[model samples]
Target: MIIIVFHIDSQERTYIERITQDTAEGIKTLLKNDLEKRITSLSEQSKLSVISSGMSQSDWDAISKNLYGTQYGYQAIGWIDSTFHVRKRIPKHNNEVTIDFNLALNPPALLTAIKAQDTQQRAVTMPLAFIHGDEGIGIHIPIFNANTRGNKLDGFISGVLLFKPYIKSVVPDFLLNEYYFTLFIDGHKVYSDQSNQPAIAYAWSKSSSYYLQGHEWEINVSPNDEFLYIAHYKVMRILIALGLFITFIIVLAAYTYLFARSKLKDERYKIEHLLKNLPGMAYHSSNTINRPMILVSDGCENLTGYSRAEFKKNRMLWRKIIHEDDFKRVEKSLNEAFKVNSPFELEYRIITKNSSIKLVWEKGGPVSSIFNGEIIIEGFINDITSIKEAEADLISSYAFSDAVVNSVVEAVITIDQHGLIQSFNFAAQVMFGYSADEVKNKNITILMPTPFCDQHDQHLAQYLKTKQTHIIGVGRELIAKRRDGTQFPIHLSVSEIQNHENTMFVGLIRDITKQRASEEQARLHTEQLAHAERVNALGEMAAGIAHEINQPLTAISLFSQTAKNFCEKGKLEKLPSIFEKLSLHSRRAGAVIERMQLMTKKGQRSKEVIDCIFMIKEVINLAESEARLRNITIRMTACDEAVDVFVDRVQIEQVILNLLRNGMEAMQLNTCDNGSKIELEIKLNEDKNVEISVTDTGAGLAQEMRERLFKPFSSTKENGTGIGLSISKSIIEEHGGHINFCDNKPTGAIFMFTLPIYEKRSRE
Candidate 1:
């Protein structure tokens, strides 16, 4: 009995020793591997941060927080500059005091950092006390400037690893509970969980070593009192009771059988739980024509709205549930897969017990039945209705957007940040004289003219870099080039579309060639209309003009006669004064003719600065004789200051003369008993504009005539051409002014117009 107990004890001790050795090796390996992985990750991150430019505080904090979460062994992660100054640290709330700490204060860490920088590699320091009172080692990863040719050292990413927490983290709780451990670094004990009590002499112990980053770490593992009591002493006592060995053997066999059965039952329960929680249905089916279901998981009810018992009772239930349209395809796929003894995938619709249709995807393969070794099919079916619906929605969205873009009348173009055209709509194709295929992937500069095309790329790059916009979100009228090499005006509005992945520009372009042409034609027509009106006014004043010219001509003729007589008489001394008078009369006749010529000339309208008061005086002079014939008096009022206006002189004169003539005619027709008068006033208004008013003491306009007063071809007088007021309004508005008529206080009508006061800057 003693020999058997001794042998059992020896064998148990040997077994325990072997387990202890393996545990020690495993712990050492786990610690080494975990540290190496963490250091490698830190090194890679450090290099990436440096390559990105420099290790900023945010970058450092991000890396530190990530390491703190994933590499939990680290007490703190920090950045040390090239000068060995601690610039940043993790767990900012707790470790903020460590920032700006000089690494020189800790000789070991400083040495490690210096070595890492010099060699441009990773280095580690010996275990030392950190500022936070935790004993740990420092891991330093060097960073260098990638942009420099010399690869100058930049900084170091340092991680402080706590001893006890690191060991506890790497070693599993089960292993830790059964075993006592001692951690050593370079032969010096750093951590040990053994109490001050003298170690048990019978405890099993083993030591294992692992090397990492030039440092040697040893883990010593030993079974505690509980493990020893159960595995060695108690077992020895059991072996000593040799008389009950047969009974013990019988009981052991039964226990082994029951334990195995319990284990199998537990495994089955886990599998059942897993299938119940599965997102869809799992099934086993017979490899037959109908593919009858042999077994189904609990999820079958959720997926098909039918109980498992129903599927078992009705062998044709699966076939009946398959949509008629997809059953044949499903059967064909299954047959093909079965023939080749391979896996199959199918997507089809199925009708649930409630008569609702659902789209399902199935992936299955042939397998041998454990009970009979017959081939059977097993598969998982998942509802994919939502996925299919989402796909359809996405496709429809894209199609709708495309249709809308193409339907617009203006050109719609989308370009990537690089200025390459990505999409060109139908309008763009028609406007630019290019097919969508021809312009796609082409630079947007192809549609721009001259210097703009050459500078487009540079401008785009500048905007991307500086984010300063010149034309984005703003509309500009610019010249655009067509495929035919013709340049035309286009109004382009560009908008920026930005997302996380990329930036794009959408350009809306409108071809304004026809619009510009129409405008030019309108301007020419206005000039012609103004000239025709001036000619007509001159014709109306012909009699008065002839009478006025006759006086000057008659005087000139008399002066010439007198001068000729003086010369004939040889009174040369008196002839000088006679000749002077002749010159004055001739000059006066020339001035009258020049004024007439100006009024009659037909040409493009040219604006020049002229005094408003002076222009009114000239108009009155021409119309004075006509007014006198109509028995109407013309009066003028002016301001002391000269009000200069920029306008076409002939156009303004025509407007005033038409007003004067109309007033005189109205008074003649009305035959007012009181003397009729037309008053012209020129003054500066509050808007700094030259305001001229013509008041007529004749019959005032009626209310009905006011509405259509400025409309062409609408007149109150029987012989009046309504175009006079219409033309006057157009001419005044064109000169940045307005004209309107209102009833005077008591009687007659008042015609008032204002022209912007001309400044020197306006001409420029």
Candidate 2:
């Protein structure tokens, strides 16, 4: 009994062993293909990195931004005989701060490539040796320069593939299963699976091997023991069936002698009839060369498309009927089964009479005659063509679905109705720095920060009860947490999907950090452009400013001379008024220069609650010079009443000055009796905020000008940068104010802006 049971167990073990070996081969092929492709890609990128090191900075920058057109992620560097040097790298985190490949002494492949001219090589992985503790696998291409004498090796261009994460990011998540794997570098093991044990290939493990440019990876994969439990159960069932068969045979032989000859013959015929009506053929073959099919049921001809006589005569023999590709496997399995004296179940393809193929399963055991040493093989063979085809279709459908999910660029995730994560794809793994293996069946809130995580269950509960949507259907920007506990912006869109007995939430998420960064960068560029325009505006008004200062200086000089003359002639009465005028002129000149200086300076200054009256007066003073030169008389209303408003001083002044100058310029096109009056006003508005307006009696505005008034680079002035009004609008909006243009009374244009009131603490 023990021997028989062992026989059954051993055959199943052999079957499982074969499955594990095949799985290893497949894994090996996949890994080798990926690694070799990576080597080739790095080699090509190395050439570019080398050649571009001597190119101009701009060209290098463009190429680096594109990762040198390589599909995989690697940092490229050029190698002089002594050291590794980077020409450029982009998404620039990979930029090498230090150059030290130590290629002359380590990673023999790099040295080999360096020895030859323009040769490419792949080298062993070195742990945390490059750029932020990353496993760097060296791929080097020798670089050359043609001198006056001959072409000589200039250096080697090297690309260091950040190996670990690169592999994680490229390989499908489904493939990273429980199979224990060890990645060997040269002959030394550098990486292992989650098992973490350094294991050599076992009889059950699968191995993948890759060798290129003197570097290699021998990958061994051993399927988890749990994966073979089904086979173990099948072996138990076969052993039980064999035991019962022997017991029945012993009982039948005793009964056969007791029964009459006719009764025995009748029972034999009844058994044969029962076997013939079964789903498959029942057969007993002689254990001889050619394995002659001496007896077979009627179903044999139906399954094999051969007549009963043909099978009995061994014309269309069992061995010859097996498909060519499956013949060796079937034969090997049978040999192993017989060696263990076990019953075997095998799947093999058979060629039919019409030359079509049919998949079949054969279950058989060796039998020996009791009276003599005669040996026979008895078995049942069944056509499993439809079942196999259906299985293939099912597998194909699963593959298709997996492909679609993996192809999506977004980090797709699915969670159970209870908020536990059910699915996570490759993108999700890359985005969160967590493998699916690490997070599967974990709470979806693991990807969220404090408040979101805390509130997630409530949100789902609320949704289930109310069926109202907040974050469903629409994509909204939110912060997501990574495995490292860092937060990043993600655009999340989620929907409810029903899965048989439960509800699941499918979330489509995308990292929007780069997009937000780009927006911020654009805003800064706009601010810089505005500052340049302001400086340019200052330049345009230089002559007018000089004229305003010259008048004050001329008045001061005249008054001083007059006072001196009075002193010389003993006329002291006229000196008092002259000194007063001189002091006023100096104050006026200083205020104009100071306001101009503040407005033209670069960058943002902190906002403050500035006095509205004071600000209006200063802006008018700055523009007063240009206003007079343009023949525009400045008038003010409500200039003395104190009102405070919160704003950036320079930015606010810039808006006011721009409005004043624009009004003055407009008046240049329309001259009035009072020389194109420009009115500057400051007062409290209905909103209890400070309102400042610049009104002009110029040509006012054309319909088109009014429409595009606050648009950047939209101008009517001959030498206008067209940035002033647009910048003013931006500043006003940023300060929580709104600026607008409207008709001034009946004949002019008024450009007005309002600033929020500064809320001072009320007296207790």
Candidate 3:
């Protein structure tokens, strides 16, 4: 019932006395003698020793109580059927377990060691017990026994028993049964029946390099095989299967896509047979390719004049075959197409092997992405020489036609069906006082005066309706007003000109005011010379008539004188009648002399400004006697407003009188039953020109004679001189005007003369 303990370090035994209450030798001797006797006595179950010995009193007392009964003679010994070594459970970490012992001593007993073969056979020596030696002072240690007591014996011989190694050191598994078993899973508590029990010690069984005599022992279970197996095994298996399946699908899809793409490309190659034959032609833009070229057409040979073999030997041959001037342009277009990813087509000239140039048409577009580079360009080329030549010829022809139009002298203007001037020549611009830029698109009627405003439009409508052209075919001499509001005569010859498919009119215009003026002056000059000659002859003829009439008058006078004397001697009234007859014969001789004198005088003066209507009235008055004799009425509507004109009054009046006499002669000479009527019209025109017209209703002048009516001696009268109208023109034109002869409606000729009016000076 007593416990004894000792701690000894044999390597440092100098401190053993301080650690232990007894000396080493003294304790050894006391334990060998007295401790043995006491132990024998205890084994014999006798009374305790009371002699003075090497042991302490407390030790003696404790040992005595454990072996014998107490002082009461009460028996303390008891026989047990079974002995159990209740050990504390070991803790597991990784795959091992550790048992920590809490004995009452620091050093356990040392003794001879023995070996156990297996776990079952080694159980008897596995559990340890405490024992005292023969010394009076004894220490405690372990014994390898399967059964042991846990009374006051635990105060000594305390050491570890492990079911497995400590996971850090190697220990015998037989001795491990000294400790209790425990089980855990992933740090979760399971079974620990002896978690709080003390660890049972085992005695050193043998002296071997594999075992320690007085050291701790540990138990171990490998972590890889125990807890971790159940924890992550399921997750690892699922992940492995899923990864394998995903890898299979990815590989299969990649193979299928490559195979399909290859088949599609092969089919496309057959369709583009021409593109495959050309060797140097590239699909993508590169100098060389392990892959086949794209869009290389067979016609490439014809275009470049180089065989496929020659180009394949040198990939740059295709570029060399292109015309030098066109190479840059083609390269620029290719670059642009690549940048924009759009289709491109163009025509350019390319040089051939024979040093001849061929016009080639090229087309290209972008293709796809490759190896982190956009090196794709698709294109084709072919000859286009014929097409380009045709375009050039058409352009040349247009230029020639334009030259002809620009060179015309007359003011040529072209008008469309709408009457708008489309093309106006230089002359047309100048004549119309507008630049080509100003009037090219203006209406044709812009050159016309008002009221004649829409007249051109109406005329065009009439012409379109009637299918006849009055102004188109023939040149019409007409008067048109200028931009300055002055009237000028011009002859416009318009013709309908047709183009490739449309109808247009070209107006050829000329100014004719000068030409007409020249004709008038020539006619007057001829009339003046003819009139002078006729007047000279008429004077000579009148001289002969005067002489002949005077001789007859002398004979008649002598006969009348004799008759008068005979009547006077007879002294009858018959003498007075005879005298009256002699007086009448004297007056007749005087009238003949006066008529001859008037015809011989030829002192004519020039023209001056005069009142035209007043002059016409005086001329009518002079012709009145002749009109009355023919039973004719000469009517006059001379405007009462004074129409002052630049002309000779005498010559204009003479022209009027001759026209009146001619009308009377035509009436009498034609032997018409009703006497003729004459009409005279005079008015001042709005343009400051005077009009004097003499019209007769007698037989009209024939068209043929009217053409020459103003010529000298070109008259229809029996004794007429055409000098009167000729002189009238000469005088009127001296003041810058004109005379015109026309036929009056239904009959006679109308003589009309226009004289420039004299504008009076302002009174201021």
- What's the lDDT for all of these models? 0.84, 0.74, 0.53
- Cα lDDT tens digits, model 3, 487-598, are 6778898888777876788888887878989976875664455346435433434544555456548856875877767877985666666666667666666655544344
Which of candidates 2 and 3 is the stronger one according to TM-score?
A: 2
Which prediction has the highest lDDT against the true structure? 1
Once model 2 is optimally superposed onto the true structure by TM-score, how far is the C-alpha of residue 668 displaced, in angstroms?
3.1
Model 2 regions lying over 4 Å from their true place: 1-402, 416-419, 443-475, 479-488, 494-505, 542-594, 604-618, 628-649, 673-676, 680-693, 703-712, 729-746, 752-764
lDDT of 1 at 213: 66
Q: Of the candidates shown, which would achieve the greatest TM-score relative to the real structure?
A: 1
- Backbone clashes, each candidate: 0, 2, 37
**TM-scores of the models, in the given order?**
0.47, 0.39, 0.32
Give the per-residue lDDT digits (tens) of candidate 1, residues 1-764: 67877777778878988888988888878888888898888877765544232557676666667767876767778877778887877877667668899989988888888888777789989888888777889889887777788987777778888887877787888887888888888998888877552367324678999776677888888888788888788776665555588778999999999899789879988999999999899999888766678999888888899998988876446888899999989999998998999999989999998999999999999999998999999999998999999999999999999999999999999999999999999999999999999988999999988999999999999999999989999999999999999999999999999999999999999999999999989878867776776777678778877777788788878878887887898877887787777788778677777877888887666888888888888888778867766768899999999778888998899888888887777667778544577788888888888888888777788888888889888887786656888888998998889998888767788899998987765211
Q: Please, what's the RMSD in Å of model 2? A: 25.0
Clashes (candidate 1): 0
By lDDT rank, best first, the candidates go: 1, 2, 3
Off by over 4 Å in 1: 1-391, 416-420, 441-445, 450-479, 489-507, 512-529, 573-580, 631-633, 671-673, 762-764
TM-score, cand. 3 vs. native: 0.32
